[model samples]
Target: MPLQKTLLALEALDSAYVNGESVKQLFGAYPRVTVDVMTVQGEKGSTDFVKVVVPGSEGKRSGGQAPTMGIVGRLGGIGARPSRIGLVSDADGAVAAIAAALKLADMQTKGDTMKGDVIVTTHICPDAPTLPHEPVDFMDSPVDILQMNEHEVLPEMEAILSIDTTKGNRVINHKGIAISPTVKEGYILRVSEDLLRIMEMTTGQLPVTFPVTMQDITPYGNDLYHINSILQPAVATHAPVVGVAVTAQSAVPGCGTGASHEVDIASAVRFAVETAKEFTAGICSFYNESEYDRILGLYGSMRVLQTAGAQTTPAV
Candidate 1:
């Protein structure tokens, strides 16, 4: 199962200097996947964006026109070093995403490749800064939000699954995983039945879902509250985006240590891997295209929500 991949990813990411080079070295055994590392520097420090592509048998790379599914491990940082030690709760997203990539790559090596390509993107930064929040602290990124979206959200991605560690909130009280509704352009559509079925089959429990407000769907730098950066990728692309949240029964600080449950992380990884397989095979759909077209024709566009609006004046 995904337990092996989960452990491998956790061990690899538990280091202080776990950069892209280390990831590249770890995935060297899988020759079917292509790993690329791009280092970007910000005001605080530098973080490496690690992108691993597991090519499908009849995917677009071979001119087969199969849609590509993107799995982005959305997180502030893997570790909040200099402030906190070891792996933080925010690292769950990175770990799960990496584990999914590893499992898919290994499957390819065993002649079980998917029908379309899977692009997995996440960053590696051990010593990231921590920001204060209402209930608890969050692991802030070394770079800004724009830089994060630019690197993680690729244009080739037809649909994106933005997985993040969402235990730092009190809204969702599940102890395993949760999914969000399909967010496209500026509309938050209904949750896909296909995804719900996959989640049930993987976890053998009722599916859990989290709420997304208008403010949450909007981009960062808007001076608004977001549960986390899980849906931030929606601001940069036209593709439908859904958030896969790793949750807890209680609100755990993102900077808290020893909060990541390996079993839950593995469950999320399994869900992602299965979704990647089904989505690319044309057996799953994120949203109804005809309904979306009708909505667009009737109500016009909500694209303005994707940007930061005009600066408001201070109240007298």
Candidate 2:
């Protein structure tokens, strides 16, 4: 089960001094996994971007042509210290992403490597600033969205599973994990049935899906209201992106303390791990290529939505 991995990630992140080096050490035992840590500075502060690469047997890293899947633990920060204490709700995405990486590393050690490579990226920030928002405050990241996309959204990733704690909104009222529709370029395609089947098989419950708007899929810093940063990766790459959301029955602030639920985070971890397995093996399809081609041929391209539209007013 992912319980152990989730616990391990939670323990690693619930620290005032947690950084990329400390996180890298956790994967030293798995030689097949390579971990890198780079410090990125933003206007407000700095944080370490921790990237974990688990090369699969037939994956591109090994000279094979198997597709690569990116699993990004998208979040503002793990903690909003000085102003708040302890691991906040925003930490769930990082926890889930790291936990999934740990689990994949362990599987590799046990001769359970998949067919494609998995690239996992997340930041380590113990103390970050908090920002004012509508229903609840957000845990501001040390780096802004552009910086985050530059570091996390690597071109090698053909498709991405962007996991984030989506409990800060009233739109999605679920207790476990929910998935979003396939977002590619600028179109909000239908939810992948294969993903739904996998989610049902993994959780043994109905697959829960959250909504996404045109503005939500666009890049951040656009002054538009987003459900959260769950879909930020979509704006940075042409890859088909899906959001794995750790949810709650009620709204919770991103900076709220002691609001992280291990079970819920574990659920997201499991979902991501399963998706990685299927996606890498070419057994899962995020969207039908022929159907997508038909749409493009009929209506033309919708790439404009990926950018901040022709300037009318600056984003505040």
Q: Judging by lDDT against the true structure, name the best candidate.
A: 1
Among residues 3 or more apart in sequence or in different chains, the pairs in candidate 1 whose N, CA or C atoms overlap within 3 Å are none
**Predicted candidate 2 versus true structure: per-residue lDDT over 1-316, tens digit per residue:** 6889999999999998899999999998998899999999888888999999999999998799898999999999998888888999999999998999999999987889999999999998988899888787888998889899998999999999999998888899889999999999898999999999999998999889999998899888778898889999998899999999999999899999999999889988998899899999999999989999999999988888889878786589
Q: Candidate 1, residues 30-132: lDDT per residue as tens digits?
A: 8878999999999989899999999998899878888899999998888888779899999999999999999999998787989999999999999889889
How does model 1 score by TM-score? 0.98
lDDT of 2 at 299: 92
Q: Clashes in each model (backbone N, CA, C under 3 Å)?
A: 0, 0
- TM-score, cand. 2 vs. native: 0.98
Give every collision pair in model 2: none
Q: Lowest lDDT 10-mer window, candidate 2?
A: 305-314
